[model samples]
Target chain A: MDASKIKQGIHKSKGGLIRSFVTIENGAIKDIDVSGDFFLFPEEAFFKIIKELKGIPAKRGKIQEIIEKTYEKENIQSPGTEPCDFTESIMKALEDT
Target chain B: MNRWRFIDFGLVDIRDMMAMDEAILKGDEGNTFFFWTPKKSIILGYFQKAEVELNLANCKEYTITRRISGGGIAFSDDLGRQINYGVVGTIDNDLFPLDIIGSYKQICGVLIDTLIHYGLNAAFRPINDVVVTPYLNTGTKGARKISGNAQTRWEGKLLQNGTLLLDFDIEEMLRISNIPREKFLDKKIASIREGLTWLDRELGEQRDMEEVKGIMKRKFEERFNVRLKTGKLSEKETALTNSLLPKYYSPEWVFR
Candidate 1:
């Protein structure tokens, strides 16, 4: 039976640095939190997008697609950070804790 | 050429200053540029986890607040005397276009010109920073940081506020803040001072804040091709700021 695990990752965005901690359970994202020194436009949209990540398949492509959908729905402009960076940060967590 | 409303808010609480930024960004009152400074405080970036970035133990004596803008944390001290300016303008405007880095370059160019007016060699580092190269700078490191900027957009407007250090006290800063070691390690500098600078340190003399403000006003007028007509907050802005004040001091906002 797949159990829950927490993982963390960091990425240096063009604008600054961003970090993520994700909780995965049963091959799906149980919860995730993100923080960074990077700039992102429409701060509210960023929150809304991240919230949608819950229950998402704990996979790179799925995470990126969900973030992309949210970005397209809103007029997002993250100068140094791209939507994909969030996925990369989540997936980059090489170790389980 | 355009006319921009300008206000001089000499000194204010950090929470109030941040509230004012949001009030201005959320309003449709055209563009505004305000000169203001905070009393002793620790200002965190929007995305920062305060516990991780700030030394709460040492920060007990300091008031803490967070900015809507995304960037690193900044420490404010009234005695340290920094030239803090806030520019709020419409995103569609040519001066601060929708593009992020481009807008940073264009806006920071005005700041660079201001430093040049005082015979200092200043340059804008990408993302958001206005730096003045130390007179005796050497090696791969060309300049020391004198200013740091952070920006945010609300609706169709943008707010770019930054601080230019008139004087810096690294020891005092380290006491209240926990700057990541990597910041110093990445630069290959012995002490942080080698990578940081201030007006007093560079000029070896004190320049009246008024004189600096006057020069800054001129630079803005020349670079943005706009006249900064002195003004006060609109009734709408005042009320909005008042409404937003309490939230700034709330634990949720400050800790989040």
Candidate 2:
């Protein structure tokens, strides 16, 4: 799968768990949507985490870091899913950008 | 050159105490440490909007008062379950910056050292959380967060406080916060569980709350190497607390 294509799919998935992606284009983030069936806290936790990462110099890297940090701190588990893999996919997307 | 005070007022709600602290901060007169009441409450961050941050209906049902601290929201059930601490004095500007991370660690460090004394594995988590590990017989993974601290910095004085969860009701917490139930059902929520642990769980049934408070006070004194003078709010502080009470209790402040 082309990383960009996967990124585009993630950007379009919007809501309902699994996974989500927000694209950083021209120095601004665009296309924030979720894919897969994953559970997040506080409903606002996702937006809050995302908002906290906004306007950073390395937007993608920051997002990945925050997500992983929150996951580790909150003790969130996604069944058989691996957070590292998810992070790698996002990193791949960023590289393609 | 400073006396560290350890107050035991039982379980006072956050609103009344916050009002008292604010009055002292504004120089309304009396400044003292207090430990009062056995009430349960949730204090919102100073900059947080209560409506957006709390579930009003649940709070009303539970008789919890929102507080005036800036950071994340925390729930405290009673004096036994948690103890609140505040420091009021003219802090040297050069000693600490009035920033979030700076003040947070300073106060939390005291509790961290105290917990370590009990032979409990404790560490400070960023932003403002103290955690213990290995799930007190529940076989849970990750560091269990034992304490959550918040601070209010004004003028040259800093008032930092925290909730030491002797025991926590995780399910109730998820229900009270503005977060949805379904969201916490995911494996993500369990990961969060790993990061938190209660003192009661760690010590089993042999722990003493008063003894813990004494240990904390001793560590605080040792950390700052100051004598903690036992005293009550000055008449000025009481008056200030009373005057500010109406405002802090009003919808404008609570909802805002």
Candidate 3:
């Protein structure tokens, strides 16, 4: 459950599907990484959305709120692209801790 | 379709233009203006990590401000560098192709055609760059990159802005880019100038910046089939840009 350990795990899971991992140690996110294969759009574009999300401030008690806030920040309205579902996945990842 | 307004203010800050774009997207009164930075600066793509993309020492020594747009890093200085044109309007799905390839071909086609007017053989290279092939005997690929563009979509509007390097300092670019220094040690910098060229360089003299702007405006009008209207910054646009300028010029935004 060490923060460094979580960071390492997320960084190592650089597989093909668009996946994000948040490294939490002692109930606080220490690191995060979003990676995937060739996306319909540029990976850089998605990363930009993540960067904006990181700009917001959230308390440790508001983990789900943080995820939702970050997802809403992306503002992607393309057909079938659900930001809320994406946030759910991140919340699930955090809950796994 | 709304007519595109052209503002030709020379060497205005990039932050102002970005703020103006945001205001326009938010339905605030603002005129689309094209402005250039006076010093060499790296505008990191909106999503890029500034720490990863910019060299702090280099930017400070050279005095270039970073931009908020998304895409690869670009280095620019005032060697005939014209004001950057920002087209602000409602996002028209019809105007922008759904796919990246189609979009690149469409936007770059207009640029290539414009360059052809100046007698330079410019071509649209893949992944979103317009380049001219360097001469063979010159040991240059002749594929000099004349422009680099980036886009930002917000609310219901999209802003695509880029630069056309009229004349650039190769040494300054080499200092800022990810290219290794040793590679330029043995060859003339000009030889390696493939995928990069300037109108002034091609013409062997510094051409009038206003003339170049006129040509680009004409091309945009013809290709987009919209009249190019002349306008200045609206009061609301000016106020927004003024508000955003401090943050954009701040160390936090630049070094973030």
Q: What TM-score against the true fold does each predicted structure earn?
A: 0.89, 0.64, 0.66
User: Candidate 3: fnat, from 0 to 1?
Assistant: 0.00
Q: After superposition, how far is residue B28 of candidate 2 from its true place, in Å?
A: 7.6
Task: Report the C-alpha lDDT of model 2 over B1-256, residue by residue, as the tens digit.
Answer: 7654445656565677778767666663323344443467766554345554567777765544445444556676533476666655455543344444665676688788988887777766655667676536432235567887655555566666676777777767766776433333532445445556677778776467778888878887776677677766667768778998886677776664
The CAPRI-style docking tier of model 3 reads incorrect
Q: For model 3, how does the per-residue alpha-carbon lDDT over B116-180 read when each residue is reduced to its tens digit?
A: 88877777655456776643423234456678765555555555666777877877765565443
- In TM-score terms, candidate 3 sits at 0.66
Kindly indicate the candidate among 1 and 3 with the higher DockQ: 1
- Which candidate achieves the best lDDT against the true structure? 1
lDDT of 3 at B120: 76
How would the candidate models be sorted by TM-score, starting from the highest? 1, 3, 2
What does the lDDT read for residue B145 in candidate 3? 68
Residue B232, candidate 2: Cα error in Å is: 0.9
Worst ten-residue run, lDDT, model 1 chain A?
A: A1-10
What fraction of the native interface does candidate 1 get right in terms of contacts? 0.58
Clashing pairs in 1: none
Cα lDDT listed for each candidate? 0.81, 0.57, 0.55
By summed lDDT, which 10 consecutive residues of candidate 3 chain B come out lowest? B179-188
Residue-level lDDT tens digits of model 3 in A5-67? 543211111111223456654555555654321122332346555554453432333544654
